[model samples]
Target: MDPRQEEQINAQVIAVFPDKVRIIVDDLEDFKIAEESLKVGSYVKIADNENAVLIAIIENFQIAVSAEGKRDHIIEAFPLGILRNGKFERGGDSLAIPPKEVQPATISDIKKIYEDSVPKEASFRFATLSSNISVPVPVNGDKFFNKHIAVVGSTGSGKSHTLATIIQKAVSEKGDGFSLNNSHVIIFDIHSEYKSAFPSANHIDISNLALPYWMLNSEELEEFFLDTEANDHNQRNIFKEAIIKDRLAKFSGSASEKQNIHLDTPILFDIREVLAYAIAKNEEMVNTGEVYASSNKEKAGQPKYTQGSLHGKLTNFVNRLENKLNDSRLNFFLGEQSMKITFEETLQKLLGYSSKSESNVTVIDLSGVPFEVLSITVSLISRLVFEYGYIYKRIRCAKNPNEKINNDIPILLVYEEAHKYVPNSDLSKYRASKVAIERIAKEGRKYGVTLLLASQRPSEISETIFSQCSNFIAMRLTNPADQGYVKKLLPDSLGSLIDKMTSFRQGEALLVGESIILPSIVQIEPCIHTPSSSDIPYWQLWKEEWKNMDFAAIKEEWYK
Candidate 1:
């Protein structure tokens, strides 16, 4: 290098920290060397006498410096880092020799090194001294928020609690302006834990809530009647006809069919009407004749008529249907014969419009639904929401796909205790929760529907569904099968973080995947809105006694 060029260079070693070093230099105009591509976390080679050589550069740098003495002399303060392998002189001034060479590290190789060196506590985000390269940083974008997410933990691992924290952070984090206000989420809350978790959403609980069974397609209806056995084609048709009649009868008196009602419309069907039709169609006629000539008197045999013969036999079935229809406790399509309330009133109340805003996050409470029907009810409601969105888009964006901005309201469905519904397999091939969940996993993304599945047993969840998740929030897992299942889905880079799952705190979780550049084990923020269905303190309740003890006096007064 030329002497004039060296004179033009202004180099100053800023402060040297215990572990790292910082330096500043003028523009490359002076060094005249081609190795001026130094950056934070990059390696730069400095050589003296060809053999006395060392390398370091820029861990971090500021555009301006603010030290007291000689602060004006330094135009910039750049930190330099040297690994334990290289040594820097304590009081070395500027070296006359220039830097040798500099190059950018391969991101792939760095990622590999990162996976191997990351600490167990690190989630998808990590910074380590094992390599000179920086781990990938998770920026808020399509890569992170738009990707699918899954949370797996045991029953009490606080899955719902963790999810609430993550969503809260996503909207409030620095540098990210993404908010949940514009998002439309439809949660299939089997346990109804999230009713109060988010206050903004419209909550629809299907307890004794009636859904028109006729609204179900033939496939759905078939699944509904899986337990009933019908042999001949006639028998099957009889059942089908009975179902149709009951449906029509249930909706008959109120209003005319606005649309050409077909086998497809998802309106409420009358279970009472259908069962009545079934009984009526299956009834058998009986004929009785008195034997008159049997005892040598030889009275002629003639047909005998009984007044309540048919009525007597049909009594039990009618009673059953009437009892079901009359059960005022049940929210049935037809009001129980015993209850004076009409079906029309119940239907109106159920389908009545709620000012549910798509922008506001809504949590529907499902705790009131009966255990026997919980799985199917959850499936039906979720399917209905997605189906509604699918239809809404087709009409709004008729000709062009790009003109779908008006139709794009992304929704996230958080399934708590997802394993109960979406188990591994269905040997009988009925209305399996696994199938419904798999459909959402594969197709929900296109319809602007996303699922956030929370479960303790990953091994019990469908492999295909679990594999589709792009981001994962993992807490403690003692089950080896679950651990092994998660291991398969986890990136090799997150091996260490997976090991920490067993020791994670109640609300703490290892967050890994696209949303985070490196895996990070974070303490989730506590939720402000409390869930309604937590365990109660029975022991404490028993400690309290009744306020009044006038039992003997009350009895004496009554006797007097």
Candidate 2:
């Protein structure tokens, strides 16, 4: 240690309370030299230019002195280059101390960073974390979910589990949010998963679900009854009009009766009914001239009428409709099935049908709903919610200032298989799933109706919907496309953490966005109630099989 070297050792006490110091250097032209050459976390020594003992940069930079009390000026030694007999420190005179490096912080550290942020999930019941891997923080009116949210992931990547977990969590919250007087949730179960997952939900199995014929307008009914064989636009309308009239006559309330009248409106009729009517009329039209029936064959003199152009058209339509109804795949929408309840029953149930008391929560299960009409049913339900919200908001703010409004009640729509509805494509039109989701994403926030989407395919989800989500608890996504999609969607600050999604354990998620201070990789708490997402252990089943059964017994047992 030298005296002259002490002058070259420049340093400053930046933080006195914590005893922190900043090393002063001539030029950091090469950060590598500064970083590697200096002892980031160590004691320092210094020497003077004349190679004389100067000071030791320890508790305070001071000249070294004898152990026995000696001089007023405490001399310190500063090393020009740290020397341990044979080594030469490349950097300048003084060294800086580095903080202790911790390899990785605990899961609580990850959760706390986000939990302590704005629009915080301060007080919500903890649900199954993303995929049961990361902790799920259920948000309602008090949290950011009152705005908008989006979830994305790859197929079979536990998107459905994540969504189901959220719905369950929200329902729990609503039941617990004793302050709220009403909470009506209407989910559009596109895949029928929601219908089954939440049994308490008003399940509208589209199969048996029928809309009151009078509810449809003339144009809608026309579209519904558009004849395939009748290529001529004019001819199609004529047939459509006829079908509408028949349906109105059949379902409408009678004019004379003043109640339950028929034929006072325009509506859609079953293609079967329309076809029968057209066939009978075509026989008479054929006798007239321009319009005619094909056959005439009655009891001898009373000849029966044959099929005509109108009859054929109507008959073909009925056949097509019948075929569609018969197809098991398409039967969910048009089939005559009893597995599901009617739409009217569902609607009434949702609107406090039996209970005079307005409930704060409603779950619409789609498990019994058919696959084909799942999307359609979901769209209709979402539309109904949107329409009601619009109406309620208006009335609350309308004329009477003193009129009480149920503003505290917020309806949250949860989608279990969210990616299907908001796919990566331009789902701007031609998709019932897309339209329903987009409506919730675009307008639900304003009316206090929030949406929580859960999906595994972040890459395949619609960008519009994904971008709207301000808060996210993303689980592990190993697929590169899905990882890339989330990376693209999240903020730049989360780059370091998101890069680890592929390696994250199932149920573990990266929590970020408005609710988080810094993006975190969290280990979520387990769900209170277990959901139905579990794999069958084939090995366990095989172990139970034995040679004690005959062919019939084996077959029966195997089938069972």
Candidate 3:
């Protein structure tokens, strides 16, 4: 901050606006920056007459030649904040008519912007400034996670690695305490990529995942069992009546108490019994003096028969239900474990809680799950967690009227490739999942349940869910739609700053929102336990010797 540095003017501030500043250097050979390197996302400092300084991020570069063949380097930057009186302020500005001088921000000057703004205790450092790896970037951990977060980028842009890095840091850092922390995270890993990242996590894949058919809500049940093309009202009514009767019959309560059980209740009932009831109704017979096998036939006995009201109505419904039951892939839903598993045990598994050793993460590997029920699976799980938070909060408040915390052990639900389940489309298959997730996005904050949504295409995700995200780590997005979608969610002041997203290298991200002290371009630190997301080196592998294959084993699993 010495005034003597002003004597060596490095660049000229030609134009200054509320949100941006333009600087041009007439002599490229004598640019003489501290680092002797410059890039579009680098930070620079400009001083006004009162000795106050403004920090800006370089957005774009342009070069022009004069008539005499002299070159001028034009640097356009977005103003981030102002530093005055040894105090750094974020996004408030006042300036004298022509700024005193502009200079490439020295390392100390740059560090002051981030270090002074956030308290040491609240900082959660997982990445460093893209311009300087030595300068670490820390965000407010509570605000970042309590509020929903989004991590979006194109394929091969390190979106997976970035998410893994944040989660690893979260689980590993507990203020130099014991080996484990209460931090709980459940990742819906569509491609089974996170097991390596969290080796000790409670991993559940199709082989052992037990999602009872009785756990699905009414909407999910309809979507799973009803045919949208046929849209049969009789079939729906039959299914509803069957489940309700089945639930009532299974309840050991009084007649009046059985009235409380509805079709959508989470109470466990035999789906097979419901299927049997449907088949019986479809083949039911009634008598209206229709046909008689009488004395003309012979001596033993005689009977009259007629088709009942719903005799043929439920034929298709029975077929669909029967096919679903027969499919071996869906055994996870109808398996004996699911029928026997209690709600408390299922919750413990999802929350990574146990009397023995407990882990901080639960990875649900969906790769082995059947595709037809993906939405239903996601919906059921999300609903379970949200209800856990809601009911847990209610119980705490009931016990202690002054209890402020909803859940003593809060949980974070992460959806890798979230768009696949919660796409913007209004298709029937996505309805249940969308409703479940959208409810969380709107109300989960108070109940201590939050989401971390990571996807390659943000534009394709549900807008209601995306808009609820208070923080975003946007990496290199080459697609215009994805870029524009992100731009719309951020503040208008950051429009130019976001333009630098495409130019970022792999693992570089524009970290912005309520969590961080300042919006900045940062390089995520490499995770100690990497995910299985690395791209294959096809060319080099092809040049090497032929690799052996185990088609028998592959086919064995494939058939199953």
Candidate 4:
């Protein structure tokens, strides 16, 4: 090799470590190609004499003043992966002792790492490289959606926008011909922000939502109606007994199944009938058989009566049950409409499968759901998706046992602002949702149900659910707890890169996990239609002309 060629290289490898490699830059302005100068977050390739090349991202730069008053530039970079035989494989530190050549990664080099590694048909693009906006980043679509995804950030940090962009690209991207694709997405829009984004979606609010109350499992039933604060054992036993009996007596199914009924069975059982049964049990008299004499036939036998064992025990339970039945706010799940609707019909509305409504996205606006029963609603929906997957898989395998690829119409459930219901606390109010969602996080993928959880307060989310996420889009987070919580991805070789979370601009995020070819800091592309998540321009609105108040209208709407 000529010495002049070595001098023209501009960058030289000085050192290599397990997690990072050191490089010394002879001249920063020597490279007039690659579209950019070397800086933090830039990708570079280091090669040794043995043909082993390692890909690394620049972390920080330092300037050292020599004894001769000369200045030297040194770069510290975190090793991302190694390029072997024209393919990029994750896991670094395979380079030999002293690397011979170091240079900025060309556009082609960046593409080879992010795009060429994944088949063009399997690529899903939602963002571009933060260092080079022209380079679009692609992730393996199957790995991304099949596994759970977590997107967390501070308020106004573009979490909603990121979710919208991903889903929008998914639903609109067509394969062969222009017919409807095989994509199905159900978004639990807690703040009612997704309807505007998916205008054609099957948008169901509390007014149109008919989630049956009978479908709730025992835990959800107790969490829904029973006073958790009281913790009365009698209330629980009586409620369970009443529901089982009511179901057995009313079920028109085969007698054998009725005999095998249990408290957790997802069958139709009247809550009003359960309340009536509780009332009857509470008011029963113990003065029946022996206390009544044969003299009653002639003397109208006046037999003494005693209060039944459950006389006063169920008073509070029955009263609370009746109050909840009469509460208009709770009518969405408790009313006759919810009971009349079959599980298939409910799934039709929720999955956008009904003949009347055909769409790829179903946004269940949860803002109108009563806060007290929010957990119950989320639990019921999450369980429904999981069970659908489980049942669909069973039926498919029953027909064709050779290959058990279940759930042809796979679904992804998006929980926007997930912490409101599935919080980390052991409080009984959050138990229902936490259990249902955690089950999905653990085993939903096998049955074709995956989760896309987006929240601003990630530290408050249940670890059982949050830890199972295989993909993450961590945006700007200002809170220390959130920052520290997200920084645990350090094991992915993000050393000092994770420290930049505090300063990332809106729409920029640290993209990592099993989906992408390599972890990257990316700028989320502008979504086709953004969510209604922008902050209210208070100061801008205050400059408008004074307006009259309408208290009467507000009061009337509040009552409804």
Work out the TM-score per prediction. Answer: 0.59, 0.59, 0.92, 0.95
**Residue 21 in candidate 4, Cα distance off native in Å:** 2.0
Off by over 4 Å in 1: 1-141, 167-180, 206-210, 225-236, 245-263, 267-269, 284-353, 356-359, 399-401, 404-406, 427-432, 536-560
TM-score of 1: 0.59
lDDT of 1 by residue, 130-186 (tens): 223244423234444456778888656677776765554443333346543354455
179-291: candidate 3 lDDT, tens digit per residue: 88889999999998999988988898998888877888888889988996588989988889989988887788898877789987888788899899998989998766544
Error of 1 at 532 (Å): 4.2
The lDDT of each candidate is 0.54, 0.49, 0.87, 0.87
Counting clashing residue pairs in each candidate, in order, gives: 24, 82, 0, 0
lDDT of 2 at 286: 44
Please say which candidate is ahead in TM-score: 2 or 3. Answer: 3
Q: Global lDDT for candidate 2?
A: 0.49
* Ten contiguous residues with the weakest lDDT in model 4: 1-10
lDDT of 4 at 359: 90
Worst 10 residues of 1 by lDDT: 75-84
lDDT of 2 by residue, 1-560 (tens): 23433233333222211222233332222211222232211233332233322112222233334578532222121222232232333223333333111011123432432243334334553333332234344333355556666655454445555566555655565345484435556554545454446655544444444433333334333333444235655446555556556665665456654343233242335555655655554443343223334453433344344455555444555555556545555444444432244445545655434345444345555665545445555665665566667777787877666755434455777766666555666522226556666877887777767777777666777677778888787777778887887888876534245666776665566666554333444555544443454456778888985746489987974553
Predicted structure 3, TM vs. truth: 0.92
Native-referenced Cα lDDT, model 4: 0.87
Over 4 Å off in model 4, which ranges? Answer: 1-10, 31-35, 288-300, 489-492
Which candidate, 2 or 4, would have the higher lDDT against the true structure?
A: 4
Per-residue lDDT of model 4, residues 1-560, tens digit only: 23434455777877777777888876776632434666678778888777778889889789988899877889888898889888888878677767878777777789767778688889899999998898899989999999999999999888888999999999988977766788999999989898889998888998889999999999999999999989899888999999999999889999887888998888999999999998998888887554456667853556767888888888999899999998889888998898899978988888889778589999999999989899999999999989999999999999998755777989999999999999999999999999999999999999999999999999989988899998999898999998887786435467777788888899999998898888889999999887996578999899999989999999988987
